[model samples]
Target chain A: MSTTNSRMSRKRFSEPLLGIGGILLFLLVWEAVPRLGLVSARFLPPASTVLVQLVNYLGQASFWGDVGQTMFSWALGLVISIVAAVVLGLMIGSSRFLGRATHSTIEFLRPIPSVALIPLAVLLFGIKMESSLLLVIYASFWQVLLQVLYGVQDVDPVADNTAKSYGLGRIARVRYVVWPTVLPYLMTGVRLASAVALILAITAELVIGSPGLGKQIGLTQSGGAVPEMYALIVATGVIGVLINVGVRIVERRVLTWHPSVRGEGIA
Target chain B: MSPLKRIAYFIGLPVLLIALWWLLTLGPTNFFVPKPLKLVETFWTVWASDRLWTDFLPSIIRLFIGLAASIVLGVVLGVLIGTYRWLRSFTEPILEFFRAVPPPVLVPLLMLLIGINDQMKIVVIITGAIWPVLLNTVEGVRAVDPVLSDTTLTYRITGLARLRYLVLPGASPQIMAGVRQCLSIGLILMVISEMFGSSSGLGYTIVLFQRGFAIPEMWSGIAVLGLIGIGLSFVFRGVEGRVLGWYHGLREMQRDT
Candidate 1:
């Protein structure tokens, strides 16, 4: 038993170490290729150079401004969508009638890729922060709303009826019965939507030329700051990594009492 | 839930919204906000124009080619990763990092590397589309029935034959789901890549119209994109249904029992 426990502990510790080793090996290969003159270091700047530039950018206020603007749009859009989706999702999801009424509209609106609506957004609100907000809110709304609808549909009919029979009011039944069932789905939807919100926020910046890291990337790339461009790209990627990890952590915490969370990813 | 009532309810909201839009925009507004009727006319004119044929085909083709390439790459790479335990653990962080990088953000780098040609656009699409399929394929491969693999092993079956008969079929349903997701992402990247310095595709045309201040035409362009999106997904669903009919049958049967 002791030996088995130690083996398990060692295996657990080694997994992330293995991941780190892989990234290190990747960096080494990246560093070696440019140094070997196989590929021009100009186009694919050495990983070391990119890292140095990234460190330099960390000291710049402009970099933080870009990061802050991107995060602000992401957070604002996500919050708006979550609020909109939850309220509308709850209202629409509460009845078979409401769901059916909105079926055609939702189906039509859902597949209209938010990016494709860029020109429309630009038309309504030019290349501004509001454009990013529009795209982000539109895209993320569908992601969460659909999940919430599914959550509502998944509520046990018997439990709901029992709550009603126990003289619980609409708000109480929602609090005790509906919220528990919907919470898990909400968390999952939120986790998925958070990534999407960030994507749209950056895409809006990149395509619409709104202010953010994406705009900075385009500016640097065109202005002959290749390493800085790559560094900015890496910064976006790091933000992406942090967001994914953050979402997953928040999800686990929120859904700690849920069996599904405990049983995630069998292999 | 009468059929007539259901039909009325289903169509009512959208129709009302459209009417409201047409009504609200009846008076003159900004040049950008054209009446729906005018926009529809513009859309009709644009669709009938020769550029629609020229621009639409390449974008659609890029979407398919990139999606197909990614599906192939993903399934192949995913199977290898799933089968090899050590490699899976080692590659997880790299994959996760790459996955987080928004697909559009890679466009500039790809454009520099490949030039702003169809090839560049296609490569961007592949980069964007690959992650979903690859991750799904890995998950699917891992979820392949243990009994099937054990049986293959016990029978001394190995390599290609085992993969074909056991792993592929078991993982196919998931692979199809991944393919569906890849289609959407592929379309997105196709537009985004074209939004770069490239001059030929729907994205280019839309941006051109907007910058040129062809507001009605620009509106039409966006409408057409939405049509294409809806059309493609509907087609994809039809194909998914056909391909995964057996899997669906098995699931339904299991549910019954």
Candidate 2:
């Protein structure tokens, strides 16, 4: 047991180092390919050059503005969708009639790719932040709404009945019983929605010519600023990594009492 | 629980919503929100003709090609990496980085590198759609029952036989989930790619209509896209049912107890 524990600890410690080594090896290849003229440096810039451009972007106020714009739309759209989904999911999921009534309609509408709404968004809002918001909300809304509905359906019937038998009102029962059951599912929804929201946010800007990192990427590509384009793409990747990490951290913190999180460290 | 009640509940909301839309846009004053009847008429006129062959077919073909490529590449690489612990650890960060980058961002990059062509569009789809399947396959492979693997080892199972009989079946459910995600992501990337510089696909035609103020026609394009989305999902469900039928049966049997 002691040997196995030590071996597990050793493996865990080396894994991150292996990951860093992999990244470094990738960077080395990225640097070598262009430097060797295997592919023109004009198209695929050396990693050093892109990194320099990324550093330059960090110093620029306009770059921050673009990041701010993209993040703002992502956050606002995600919040709106979560709020709407939670309220509606609770309402629909609690009542069998409402759930049945909306089932077909939801199924019909849910599969519609949100990017297909870009034309409508452009027509209504015309490349403004609202256009991005529309796409983001449309895309992320279904992800959370479905999860919330499932979460509501997952409420323990025995506990709910017990609450009722103890003279709990509808509101009280919902507050104490429904909310806890839904919290973990809701967190999962948020994590999923956050990724979708960012994707739509970037996509809207890329297609609609809105103000964001995606647009910056487009402009750089169009203007033949290859390194800058690569830099911006790298920046978006970093943001994506950060958002994922942030969501995981928040999920752990918010769901500490949940069995999934509680039993995690023991394994 | 009655069939009549079930039918009503299923179709009632959609019918009522369509009726509400028809009533709300009854007049000829609102150009943006075309009447439901007008949209149906426009849908038939625009999509029921040769544009179906030229625009719709090509978009679908590109989507499928991209999806097929992604599935093949992702599954092959994912299985290889998943089979080996050292390889899995070494590639984890790189895969995560690639997956994190929104696939749409690849559109401009690919357009520049590969030029504005069908190849670029397909590559865009593959690049973005590949991640979900690859990542999910990795997780799925890792989750395969250790006891089963030990049994295979004891029986001297190896190579193609082991992969076919054990690894593939074990990872299939997760692989299906990834493919489901890949389908949607591929569709999105398809539209985004065509929207960029292409002139002959479904997305381009829709943007053109929107640009020319062919409001009803653009709405028709969107409607067709939605129908395609619905159709793809239905087909996916059929395929998944076949692939995961045993898994589902097992789950149900477990639940029965």
Candidate 3:
């Protein structure tokens, strides 16, 4: 058993290292291809150039300012969505009659792409950040709400009965038992929504000409500042990566007891 | 709830909301919030003038073309990656990078390289829509039960026979789910690509109206697009239900436990 365990650990360690090596090889090729002139430098800049441009932008005050605005709107929109979705989701999910009544309506509205509302938003809010916030809320709210509804539904009935037997009232039982059980699902929904919100926020700016990083990227591109545009795009990609990684860490910390998370480590 | 009560509750709320909306707009709100009745009137006017069909057709056509192409390419690539372990190892990071990078960010790069035209719009839509299908297909194929695979091997099934009998059916449900998601996302990207750059399509119509300060006309275009989204979702759900009835049965069985 000891030998088997050690062998398993060794294999796990080496496997991820192999995966990392493969990724490094891909990046190396990407950096090399443009420098070799195999692909046009106009279309595909070298990775080193992109890195340099990224560093230059990092030194700018406006870059951080844009980042702050984008993050602020994103967080505010996400907070509003979570509050609204969780409250409504709990009310609807706890009652069979309410769930049945609202399910069809939710289904109808849920599939409408929030991006399609950019025009209506522009009409309603003008080229303001309010429009972006509204769009993010719309895009993300339904996702969390649905996940919450499902999470509530997945609560074990016996556990509820057991809590009741222990003299817990409905609200207390829900607070102690149902909330903890569903918190993992809630976190998963929030993680998914975080990514969606970032995309939609940037998308809102891109389409409606809202003042954000997306607008900055658009300005750079149209002004033929190719390297800067590429740099800004790379920065946006980094932001996405950072958000994903940050959310994942939070998810891991919050859902430490979850079977899926407990089953694997970053090795 | 009984079916009748459920119907009443569902239908009544939206009606009440609409009535409230109409009431809110009646109190001299001008361009900020157009009256619901006025918006309806605008819808009729737009439909009557035939700008609706002319602008809408290009968007729909482009969307369908992009979706069709992406579905074909994503499935092929997904299957290839799934079937070959080495390929999966090589491609996973690239897939992760592309999936994380929002599609609209690519618009500037694509426009710079390819020029702003129908092809560029189509390419953007395809790139936006393809990843979900591809990733899901890979997962679906990878998740094919090893026991079933071993059974196929025991029967000496190989190559096309193995794929046809074992792999395709195993992945069909996930593939369908991926297609549904891609279609929804593709529609959004389609409209967005047009809104950002194109001179034609429903998106362009909305932009045109908004820029012209024709709030009513813009609302009409948005309403029509919303209906299209609703219609597409319903159609896909129906198709998915029919195609994956067995999967649904299995799901129900699992739920019963």
Candidate 4:
């Protein structure tokens, strides 16, 4: 509505005020929904109940363990994916012939939803963290690999020619020329892959019964601990927000030199 | 990159992989690595059964409904927020929080209220897929050139005409990208939701096959999933090519200059 009009300074942060208002409104509704008997309190449980559970969970060592286990899998899976994707993406993407050759294979493999592999993971590793890692790594690998490929391919041929004219060696060319241009894409990939890695980690734990918050959620659900389940779900949402904001900060800080990050007020 | 040569090169790797798989399963094939030939036979056998229809169609249909709902809802809300700066600000935090809640995590919560059913599955899919579409649409709509708006306004182009001629085309490329992402996310949620409680669908069928020790059936289910995955993306690309041809052309022209 303000697209054609110039806005005054007071207008800038007003929306966030509205956002705060909206969240407060939502919490009010969440609190009221059960208390007002809109739904059975036994079924929906009041937001207060869930919040109390969340507070209680914060004190429990096992709750902390679940959080730690989740973070560990997420970190480990992300690291494995980043290493594999970057190394393989760089190697394959550097050689024009190899890149072209792998295009079909990449297209074929990229779309296979990782959840489909849950049963396979289960058959292989059962409910261990490896089961989660298998799906997590496979899902996130494509996100990073594809980004790396785009990053490598995005390297200017003019820059390539200039580097060749200077007789730079293969590894040197990549280190000096390719790395700078691709770093932006690589960072983007990592950001995207990080989100995916988390989602997959949760899904794996929930579906395959791997050890994490997801499994905990499953446990609470079947055990009829509705408030505790909601608490765990909220805990997950909090982690997701933190992961997203954390990644955004990291990307902004790391890529301060990149024009997109440097010039943008908005991500 | 001639068509024939491209096709040849494309088939080459898959063919080679298939051949290698056939070779690897030559003697005493393990339970995990079903012989390629045996898998093919089992795939057909399963496909011929009524179970195939029950599992396959519902998964696709649920995913389709979810993707469609998310796209429509996302585009509407995204455009509204993007165009209205005030709306964008107030809702941004809430949207961000909702998005961060992984869709699958909602399955248990949803199951408690809604029970294990197709509706629950569809809702989960919507939750998972909506983020990309909404975010992308916001970006696309927000990026619409102020100059174009001015031109359309100066020409006395009103409301529907302006939106048709100016806004939609400008925002389409990004919208398409979002839809592509949404499709994949929706598919993932569809399968995950099924794995938990439902009686049928690809996910339920796969988990069922797995637990039942029907490895061949499980393999077929997973194989079908891969095919559906590729098929959906391929179709998305084709639709994108048609819809965004103008955007592509404009970018290419600018590149040439």
Candidate 5:
């Protein structure tokens, strides 16, 4: 038993070590390619140089400002989309006729890639926060809406009928029977939307030249700041990783009562 | 459930929305919002010309190439990593980091390294679109039933035979999910790469129209992109239905029992 426990512990320890070793190997290769002059040092600077630039960015006020702009757009867009989608989803998803009437329209609109709206966004808003928000909202809204619609549809007919027999009002029935059923799906939607909103926010800034780290990266590239451009890209990657982790944590917490979450604990 | 009812349910909302747009834009108060009819006319004139071959065709070809490359690379690498425990551990963090990085963020760096050309655009799409396929494939491969694997081992199945009979089919559902994501990412990257420092493509032409203040033309371009997106999704559904038919049958059998 002790031997098995020790082996298990050792396995856990080595897992992350393997991951770290992989990253270290990657960094080493990156450092070598430029240092050994195999590739142009100007374009692909040594990994150390990019790391140093990333550290420098940490101390700069302008870097924080850019991060703040990106986050603000992301948060605002996500919030707006969630509010709009939840309300509309609930309304449309509750009625069979309404759901059918809108199914084809939603199908048509949902597949329209939000990036295709860049021209309209640029023309209407022109390198402003609204442009980023528009793209972010459009891209993420469908994600949440679809999930919410499915969730509402999944509400148990027996439970709903039980509530109706008990003289529960429409609002009361929704609060009691429907809300619990939909929470899990809504959580999934939020997780998907959060990542998509961040991507769209950055894309809008990168392509439309809005004020954010994406714009900063674009400026650095244009200005020939090779290391800085790499640094900003790394920053964006880190942000993406952190956002994913944060949403996952939130999903777990919010869905603790969900069977899927409970099933994980058991298995 | 009748045919007429289905038609009405599907078409009613869209017709109403278009009619509303037409009514609202009748006075021409907002210059940015073009009338639906005028936009359609501009779309025909703009795309029916040489731009169809010069811009739209190239973008489509690049999209297809990038998607094909991502599928081949992602599936091959995913299977190798998934089949070996050590490889899975070693590559997990690196894959996660790269996947998290918005594909758009890589555009500038790729532009610098590869120059603003067709090759660069294709590479951008591959980098962005590859992740979904690769990650999903890895998960799918890993989820192959242990009992089934043991059975294959008992039969001494190995290499090409094993992969063809077990591994590929087991991982295909997840692979299809990845491919679905890959399609959208490829489309987005194709447009985005063209937007940056390129002379001709769908994205470039749209930007050009916007900059030139050709409002109707720009709207038309966006409409074309939407049509393409819808068309691709239909093609994907057709492919998915055929590919996953056996899996669905198995699922139905399980539910029945």
Candidate 6:
């Protein structure tokens, strides 16, 4: 038993170490390619140069301010979308009549790419954070709303009927039965929306020159500071990965009772 | 509610929205929110001048060329990776890294390297569109039933024959989904590439109008693009439904069981 426990511990530790090692190998190759001048250093700078530039940029106060603004807009947009989608989804999902009535309209509007409305958003909101938030909300609301609808649909009909037979009111039935089932889907929606919200926020900044990481990258690129541009692009990539990882952690914590996670023993 | 009443309720909301928009802009304090009536006028103005068609055609041409190239390349590479375990393992990380990098971020670098031209726009669109299809194709192929694969092998099917007869059919549903996703993404990238640095296309027209503070004309340009987006998406959905009717029937069977 002691030997088996030790073996499990060793395997657990080595799994993450192997992943880190693979990542390091990739960075090593990236660094070496420019050093060897296989590609023009001007176009694709060494990883070391990008790291140094990233550190330099991080030291600036404006960098933090821009980051804060971007995060603020993203959070605001996501909150608004989550609230609106959940409420609307509940109303629609609870009523077959309503859902059928609105399905066609939803189908019509859902496929229209939110980014295509940047011009309209810019005109309406004048390149402010409002514009960015509006675009993000537009992009993310449908996804969450659909997931919530599906979640509500997936609720056990027998459980709902049992609650109804117990003389529970509509609200109570939803609280006891519907909400729990939908929570996992809501979490999934939020996870998916985080990536999308980030993309829209950055795209909004890029197109309209709103103050964010995207604008910084665009400025650096046009100014011919290729290394700094690459560094900022890498920073954005890191931010995306970090958000994904953070969301996954939250999802695991919140969804501990979910069959998919519990059955898989993912903690 | 009855079906007709339900239809009315849905249509009523959008009608109300349009009415409110028109009412709010009736005596607009700002030019940015042009009255809906004036927007119609601006649309006709552009339409009569033949500018819309001239600008729209080039954009459409670029969109199709980019989409076709990406679909071909993505399917070929996705198949190679999906079929071969070693290739999949080798390329997975690199693909993930590139997928995380936003396509618009690559526009400037691509422009600098390849020059600001139609080629650059097409390349950006292709890069943007290819990832979704490639990833989806890989997933689709991976999800194929092992039993069916073995059965095909037992029948002496191998290589291209196996792929054509077994893998491709099984993966068609997901591939179609990927294609639908790519179509819209390709359209957006087409516009963005043009807006950022190009002399032609609807994006350039909108940017020009916006910069000049031609609010009515800008709104008109935006409206045209929105209509195009709606039209293309509808067409793609029609094609998808036709192609995936068999899959839908299978799904119904599974659900019934």
lDDT of 6 by residue, A94-190 (tens): 9987787677778778767777678778777877888889889998898799899999999999999999999999999889999999999999899
Clashing pairs in 5: none
lDDT of 4 at A267: 36
Question: For model 3 chain B, where is the 10-residue window of minimal lDDT?
Answer: B89-98
Error of 4 at A212 (Å): 0.8
Local accuracy of candidate 3 as per-residue lDDT tens digits, B32-93:
56798888888998867767567888888999999999899988899999998767866776
For model 4, the DockQ equals 0.79
Please identify model 5 stretches exceeding 4 Å from their true place. B253-257
- DockQ class, candidate 4: medium
Worst 10 residues of 6 chain B by lDDT: B85-94
Q: Report how far off residue B217 is in candidate 2 (Å).
A: 0.4
DockQ of each candidate, alpha-carbon based: 0.76, 0.88, 0.54, 0.79, 0.88, 0.34
Best by TM-score: 2
Cα lDDT tens digits, model 1, A22-99, are 999999999999899987888889999999999999999999999999999999999999999999998998888889
Each candidate structure's TM-score, on Cα atoms with residue i matched to residue i, is 0.95, 0.98, 0.92, 0.96, 0.98, 0.88
Taken in order, the candidates have interface RMSDs of 1.2, 0.7, 2.0, 1.0, 0.7, 3.0
- How accurate locally, in lDDT, is each candidate? 0.89, 0.93, 0.85, 0.90, 0.93, 0.83
TM-score, first chain, each model = 0.96, 0.98, 0.91, 0.94, 0.97, 0.93
Q: State the lDDT of candidate 6 residue by residue for B1-257, as single tens digits.
A: 67888668778767877899987877736666888778899899875687847788888899899999998998888888888755666566667777777677778878877888889999999988998789888988988889999999899999899989888888888888788778877887888898786888878888888878888888787777777778888888798888788999999999889
For model 1, the stretches where C-alpha displacement exceeds 4 angstroms are A264-267, B1-6, B253-257
> In candidate 2, which residue pairs clash?
none
lDDT score, candidate 2, position A227: 94
Clashing pairs in 3: none
Ranking by DockQ: 5, 2, 4, 1, 3, 6
Model 4 clashing residue pairs (backbone): A1-B83, A19-B90
